[model samples]
Target: MKMTKRNGVFAVVLAGMIWTFASCSKDDDTIPANIEGNAIEVAQASTIAKPGTTVSVALSFADPGNGTMLVIHRDEAPLRSVPLQDGQTSYTFEDILPADLEEGDVVPYAFFIADEKNTITSDASAFEVSVALYDEITIGSSPVYQIELPEDGIIETGKVKLAAGRKYWLPHSVHFMSGTELQMEAGVELYMNTETGETYDVVIDEGARVDVTGTATAPVVVTSDKLLRDQDAEPGDWGQFNIKGEGNGSSSGHVEYLRVEYAGDRGFRLQGVGSGTTINYVQAYRALGEGIMPTDGDVRMKYLVATNCEGGGFRFGDAYAGYVQFAISQTTSFYDEVEAFTIRETASPVISNVTVVGPGEDVDDTHGMRLRANSSGKVYNSIVADFPRRGLRLNDKVTVTDLQGSTVFAYSYIFNVPRDPYRDDTENGNPFRGYLDAENVFQNPFFNNVTGFEDNDEDEPILATIDGIGTTSYIPQTVKNSAFNPASIHAFFSEANYVGAVSEAAADWTKGWVRDYEGNIHQ
Candidate 1:
């Protein structure tokens, strides 16, 4: 006969059985005489089950011929009867649960068996079903996916693919182990839970790799969970994206066409990243700390943009021997003597074709570039404009004579800066003023939107006028002859006869991939 009755009847029977068994004496272990030597055993069940999947329960028993019956009881549900075939010793029951169960719900189940004259009821077992945390993405190998995370927070083995058009919620910091890879499809979004009051980071440890290769049209996004619920999330809502690379030889992996926004700290942290790794076409916006930070590595990057960062846009520490080109920083907020580019402590990065625009004259002492701690590099064909204070400052550790011999700043433009264009307080006297007078131009780059620098009101919205890619309102009025030294220019750079970051020509390098922060469009 088929199993029948509602969940209430099952609950009542289960309660009565529990009370009766609890009150029974320890000496009452005898079996009925008719089923004397027969025994029944149920295998251990799973502790957890995901929604929309079947739970399997296995049982083994000795039959006493007189027609046996098995009934499965779940709390508040009808009893399910299983037909025991002739001469069968073991059976497996696939119990499919309802899809609407909440994630943390505990379900109780019990098994009952009976012969012609005797009946036996097994102890109750409980399991928890997981709630759906991500939208449009599935986890695990089973048809009903399982949400499992180890206690150590590291995914030690296997490759997991985060499919496109899905948003995954990260509740804690996750680390990837050696030889394992986390591949993210284009248009995939990773959101961090910010309400927990603890910062969450995605760290790719040494020997591990994160292959997040997205197209210009469908870039991968890493942002705060608050932004997923409401678009008005502010900076410092979440932690950063960190990639700890294998030291200077081969790279651990690469990340391309990625956008990170509203990060609490640095947007991207490259630790010990070598020359073999590539980080291209990346944009960081509204970061509480530096937009991109490099420590102890030889980095290679191009087409990078940092906007509305409270700290410096690009901050380099230690020895970073790399090439950075086509970079742009716009409207960095004043943060205790911060600048667009903060280069310090023996970093010699070859930076070219860049633009740094500051928040206007009212913001006190905001710099375009703060070069200190013996940091020297070849900065060419760049524009630094509208800063409130000195355009470039060389700190006490470095001198003009040291710069003239070790660094090269050629064909660059510094415009609209007030109160000392070049400051040198290192006791070596001011050689930077004479060098600036001789090598660089102090004129406007004639950006497409000159009005972007007109106001200094702290409450006003800072708009990004120059798209940097195509159809920008800003272009240098004159392309200087000294911009390109054919003898010293690297082969990777285009020999475009332009002085600043942007040109009047229709073919702009930043076109099609660079994202417009204000408009939220990839031009």
Candidate 2:
């Protein structure tokens, strides 16, 4: 089974040639009535240019009368039009191009004109050209037995053990084959790195079974080495740690008790056709896009957590027939916690066991979760809170079951407590229509310590400054009276079955798994 996403770029360079007619276009005079010439079409503009290089464009034009001026625009921004100087009756547009292209692609623009007095514009044209010169990062084509820290390596086409303090860079279609143990010891980081190819497919494909396992006591950490620049990292600076499989391989690719942080897009973009690949106890934090984006496959996840993401807590797009259990997602600026999960012309997903929390006000592009058109799925045991738009939205043809014991609706206690009124105020277009089973309750499913879960907020332009919870100051004393303490938040649960994501566990629950940033088991 082979799926190929082609990145084809079409660049149009329009050239216009205008000329003065001897007489009005008619049958009376011997001169031709109209001027026939090529119009300049500029397709793409503003390509990143390498420091020392130029992009040239081949231009063709037809002219009956006199030569015309050609004006070109580069990049998407505004451009100053220039004349295409013509010496002879016929015109050709190929010439010396602009030097000093920025480090990337140099998209060119060329405008053409026949007569200066007469105004004529050509169709817009766009093209993408590469000029950036990055040192080729080639990991020896051979496979290695074990890997170590600050080390550069590659896996071409077989099973490789990624022991402690090791990192691997994957080229397209490289498989991690089933039975591979990509283990990271406690405090160790497994950095998956990739460079942008000439194609728009910025997502590097592993095309193989993946096993990223770590333990809580020394939780396996997977991140981009670029994050070494700062203790705290930003999103989208690197590429995705993609694990690709047709989901037809051995059911051995399992990720447990691991923390994947600072991925360029989604923390884990898992697409394995096989049914056995499982991802559980995963946490994605400070992600630029979706925390977990599953496409055309299924992933079994438990105790998954994500924070400070722009897309959603978790997004299952395409035909991702999977089961998600004990999941929690919280933030302010994501598009939606869980979305329709489809971008193709027609594609839907099956998602279950979700908990989403976000600021309610829909200022910029804030949304909770949406089931888009022509998509179908079942949602059970989920709590959506304080979304700017609809809490739970049902758009197209979808069947949702509000299981008696598994669902909750309009629960005032869980909905009313958020300081961000946008989260609790339901008057806004309520998005949870499909899941509103009559058995679902709309009361405050009270927690043990409601006030303690309040997290810290810094005055930065982005997310909060606090790490885990508690403390306005470094000292041991409780910082603020209203601050939400992470330690106290989990303990606050009083009810039997939890409403949203977090839940109170048995005294031995901590032993089940080690907790990471999103509160997922690291071990």
Candidate 3:
């Protein structure tokens, strides 16, 4: 398929300009000066100069003796010498600085008078220069900066590996045809340029594969170019990583230690990929659409985090049967129609050890989990807290019979949900009226930190907070004595001893792999 070209040569020019500005520096240390005396005076010099601006320095001497040469030195190197005849009292040296000099660069210049027998130098003067910063798009070893795959043959056959610490720019959408495989080493970054006002998607067509293997020290990053420097860039600046078609059940295609930010669409759209496709340690932030949407795929996900997404954090459809563990979705809004998990079309997923937090009572029409349209799932040993509305919702089509036989929500903790913990939309009946069993805890989860809670008396019991949770501000953690205890349900979940996604004593897995809105790199 042919990709659409948005803007013309200006986009290309902007890319070149970014590179030029990033590499240019004004470290030239050469200028001439003229003065011969223990107390030589010079006119006041400009303390600051912007790039592309001219700065002048004037020197005055007590005695302009004949045959006195004016020498200017910059950074201890002689720049130029001018002949000063008798009656010459002051000489001005002017130079225009390059436009690409970055900020915080101090250019030093000194005035000096030199003759065949004597040399006199003045104290060094400095001018701090400032230059505007630009976001850069680096194209690695690819044959062309932007590529369009043909419709017929297998493109990028064996493996196209992106090196570590390198960046690649995608000016337009790229379609990876069948049988092509792409790999990215740790610390590799992929940037999408949206200055052209056209969205771009990285499409992995049927049978195509992509493997992003990163470590905790060097995780891979995929984000819009604006996010590199512009703090105001919102979500939906660019498209997403679309992986289409079912794979060959090989473990070769997987994603690990990757962070995707400001995706205009879904951060990851996987269709028909089987359970062998591993997704671990992945974080999606500020997604305009669903953070991760899967259709007809049985994928296993672990250590996944989604925050501030307008759409659902994990949206599944069309018979997706997957296992998710240690997943956390925090600070999602109901006004944006967001939910921690949205399941439909008979999808049955097993979720455990998850923590879902929502914007408090002011938000409406939101829920922690929306299970509807013949969907059946099991949620075990998890924490759902602070949702403005219902913690879990069962639509009109779901009945008590379907919930009892096909779905299981046990050994979990639900707290601070302003609305009903369980809601059913059956015509006249409340099918989920007595579903909260002994195994489940409806009292306060007692998180170490809580913010933005409404002062209403209805939420008073869960308002009390503790202090042991480390670094618990926007994201909360539970201490050892907290209410969450995975060991309480050891038979169902034996791997973890904590109920929530994070524990105070254990190392936080989200650290060193996630990036927040403030551009702070976690860990």
Candidate 4:
């Protein structure tokens, strides 16, 4: 059963259909399963979208048969019910969003399911319909709403939601004090304050939460208003979005599909974070400093991309131990020394399936990776290429000792390094130069079209260009791999055996969602 409240985003243009399931025969003559107590879970959801945006969802569940039912609730009111046949599991909901919805107004929906025994479970999230977001409005401008913050700039009391359909400009840095929540809906974009040319930081204090989640199609963008006017805007217009935790600061964060642009010099910094956080599908472009910096603690995630960012791609340090996979980091500067991955101070993160496009041959100072401070992380089935200096460097004796002992750094390829491909610190005399031999880490691969990625600069996305020089990414036999299936190591990671982030078969993941340097978005 599909409920039409406020002519919602599920308007007539949505393929002329609503929630359709082969098992859900909601013809009024079928039975109704009265569900309560958070019954059928909303396993997945679509975020609030702009008007005229297409929204699609897929619903699937376990074998909750014995006559199941799904009930849709909007604004805490029971709307409609659908009866389901036993053993039926798949359903699809696709629709065009209503065009008249306003920003800041939430359309909270709940889905409850009832089993044969009538036991029920449910889940939900707020969905707001919004419109145009402008930087500045003159007299007689369109009726767009603006978020009003307290003069003190500390939201210490209740929840503050920066919904879609409105322009948001924080006059100053805002802090979500303890026990407060700063929620952002889908299609919500916030302008980082750049009035005084100082960094604009959003602090998620201890015991505070910040859920800045956007949908796959309508992502949440955190950029300055300058980009709206000038596509080729300079980066570093703002500062850090800091999530602080002092050795266990219980501050939680759920950031997905978020694009942080022109905000670096510490773009997104994290410390003392744990497994309770959720970070995926995140990007940092043209950052002034480290794109994503987690100096300490177990900060982990997947599907991260850092493009042309300054400082480095990801800087992990201070006893950090985490897991990362399916990541891409790139830079092409000749004067600025930028490392794709910088690890120091006992930070050891298990990383795999990454494609790092290093600085070109003109640069001679930066390595593709720098591991020091006794870091003991592992690298598996990845590609690190085009580095001018050493491909992989061990900055100290403690790091080399750990690599020879408990740390794992094997099953990856290092190519196009002009100088010493593998070398230790000069003070260490580079004596252990042959430690990372070609058997475990090699030099070349049958790259399909890796002409420094300049081959497909016009018609293709650079992230999707790391395809195998041949049919694959020159990966060895599936069993000759020291790379273990990532799923076995952690439940959060997907089962992966591929060598690099983008392969011949899986090269389209970066097609049409993220934004480019010119401020153009793919549909």
lDDT on C-alpha atoms for all candidate structures: 0.63, 0.42, 0.61, 0.60
What RMSD, rounded to one decimal, does every model reach?
16.1, 23.6, 14.4, 14.2
Model 4 — which ten-residue stretch has the worst lDDT? 13-22
lDDT of 2 by residue, 286-359 (tens): 66778777666655556676665566667766665555555666664544444312222123432333456664
TM-score for each candidate, following the candidate numbering = 0.63, 0.47, 0.61, 0.65
Task: Show the lowest summed lDDT stretch of 10 residues, model 2.
Answer: 458-467
* lDDT at 7, model 2: 32
Weakest lDDT window of 10 consecutive positions for candidate 1: 443-452
Per-residue lDDT over 1-523 for candidate 4, one digit per residue giving the tens place of the 0 to 100 score: 2223344543332212122221344334233443333233333544545555665555665545657666554544555656777776655545464555443444545454654433343333233232332224421232323456678678888777676434466657788887888887777777765657677777887678778878777777777756544444567888777776544323377887777887768777877776567778888877888888876667577888777677877788887777788887767664266566877878778887776767655565776776777777676666677767676676763443333444555556566665655546635532222222234332112221222222422212122123332111222223223344667667767777656665543344555556643446633
**Position 83, candidate 4: lDDT:** 73
Best by TM-score: 4
Q: Rank order by lDDT, top first?
A: 1, 3, 4, 2
Report the C-alpha displacement of residue 74, candidate 3, in angstroms. Answer: 43
Off by over 4 Å in 4: 1-103, 106-145, 229-232, 246-251, 400-404, 426-483, 505-507, 517-523
Better of 2 and 4 by lDDT: 4
Candidate 1 per-residue lDDT over residues 151-234, each given as its tens digit: 777899976556555567676778888888877767877777687788878888888888888777778888777755545677
